[model samples]
Target: MDTHEAAGCAEGASRRSVLAAGALGAGALGMGALGIGALGGCAANDAGPAPAAGAAVGGHAPGDAPGRGRVLGPADAIPVGGGQVFVAEQVVVTRPAADTYHAFTAVCTHAGCLVANVSNGTINCACHGSSFDATTGGVVNPPAPAPLREVTVTVTDGQLVLA
Candidate 1:
C-alpha cells in the first residue's frame, strides 16, 4: 500500500516484461529464418543449444563430435528403452537404442524449468506443462515452447561417459 513498495513492484514487473518481450522478438526472428530455409533445417531441439564441439551432457557426445561423454556404465548398464534421471544435477540419460544413448539436460529450455516427470517416453516439466519426447528431443506440448538441450553421450568400452 506504501508508495515505495508500489514503486518497487512496478519496477520489477516492468523489468520482467522487457525481458519477455526481448525473448519473444528473438524467437520470431529465428522462426522466420527457419521458415525461409535459412536455419533450423537440421535436428529438432526445442531450446537446446547448437552443440559446441566437445561439450558433453550427462555422458553423451554431441553433434557427432569425437570425444568422451559422461560414463554411465560398462555399455550394458543402460538397457535399451530405459533411462535414468540425476536429481541433484537435473539431467536425464535415456537409451532408446542398444548402441545409442541420449542425454538431455533435465532443465527445460523454456524459462530454465527443471523437468519433473518422464513417463511413456516423454519428459514433462512441472513448472509449466511443457512435455518433451525423450527419444527425439522434440517438444511434444506447449507452455515449454522450447527444445531440450541434447547432452552427447559416448560409450567407451563399457563405461558410460560424457565430456
Candidate 2:
C-alpha cells in the first residue's frame, strides 16, 4: 500500500531470486565436477581394449580387472556333463565334455546372491530356485532375467585358470 513497504517487498523478492540463482549455479558446478571425475576414471589403462557395454569378460565389466591368470583348480575336478561352483571365487566352472571347460559368474542375474550348487545338469541357485544351463550358462528358470555371465577360462598345465 505505501511506497516504502512496496520497495521493501521488492528488495526482499530480489534477494530471494539472487539466492536461488546462486544455489542453482553451485549445483551446476557440482554436477560438472562429478562428470569430470567420472571421465577421469576412464583414462587409458594396460588392461587392453575395453569390451562392449554389458559384455562379460572373465566375470568382469569393462575396466574391471581381477583374478586374471588365477587358477581355480585342477581341470580334472570338473566332471563331464556337470560343473563345480567355486563359491569363494564367484565362478561356476563346467565341463560339458571331457576336454572342454566353460566358466561363468556364480552370481545370479536376477539377484546378487551367489549360486549354491550345480546339479542335474544345471547350475542351481538356492536363493530363488533359479537354474542355468551347465554348458551354456543360459537361464533355465524364472526370476532370473538374464543368463549367467560368461567368464573366460583356459586350461594350463592341468589347471583351470581365468583368462
Name the candidate that leads on TM-score.
2
Q: Which segments of candidate 1 are over 4 A away from where they belong?
A: 1-70, 73-75
Residue range 84-133, candidate 2, lDDT tens digits = 87755668898888999888877667544556677788988654577899
* Lowest summed lDDT window (length 10), candidate 1: 36-45
Alpha-carbon deviation at 126 in model 2, angstroms: 0.2
TM of each candidate vs. truth = 0.51, 0.60
Q: How many clashes does the backbone of model 1 have?
A: 26
What candidate 2 gets wrong by more than 4 Å, as runs, is 1-65
Task: Tell me the tens digit of each residue's lDDT in model 1 across 57-158.
Answer: 334432222333445456576667767665444466777777777877776655443466566788776544678897877899986666777877667777
Quote model 1's TM-score.
0.51
- The lDDT, on a scale of 0 to 1, for candidate 2 is 0.63
lDDT value, candidate 1, whole model = 0.54
